[model samples]
Target: MKPFYIDYPQEKIAEHQHAYRCLHCKIPTTIIFGLLENHAKDCAYRIHQGRWTQLEASLKPIQKHFDEPHIDEVD
Candidate 1:
């Protein structure tokens, strides 16, 4: 899964204030100072992050199957 980055403007960053917007949910949060805060606990985008991990885990078998070498059958 791709990492999520804060999309606050340059001026905001220069002023030490940030407005966090979730790319997936399109929700805008209040202005924050300094360190970045985590997304809302109930945000669907946040929930999807966990799902992405599960999805990758579930795909591991399929990935491995394609990665393994196959031998030709002889009659």
Candidate 2:
């Protein structure tokens, strides 16, 4: 897991020039501190990330044995 959830899209806070927050959840960056749980449960970023992780886990290739012979394709 990432130490921080900084990858989510951010929008500048209107009142503070330098302050930013999550675009979907509107939670301040300082408050979120990179933890996904800090974002709202229905946050768009969180929802997309959940599905992305699941897809990646399911798509992982199985490990092959070292003893397996290599086959070369004919030219």
What is candidate 2's local distance difference test score? 0.86
lDDT (C-alpha, whole model) for all candidates = 0.48, 0.86
Weakest 10 consecutive residues of candidate 2 by summed lDDT: 66-75
| Clashing residue pairs, backbone N/CA/C < 3 A, model 2 | 4-34, 5-34
Q: Could you tell me the lDDT of residue 31 within candidate 1? A: 32
Per-model C-alpha RMSD: 8.4, 5.9
Tens-place lDDT digits, model 1, residues 1-75 = 445434433222233356444544444544322213355566565666667667988887653345544587454
Highest-scoring model, TM-score: 2
Local error of candidate 2 at 32, Å? 1.2
TM-score of 2: 0.67
Per-model TM against the reference: 0.33, 0.67
Clashes of each: 0, 2
lDDT of 1 at 41: 62
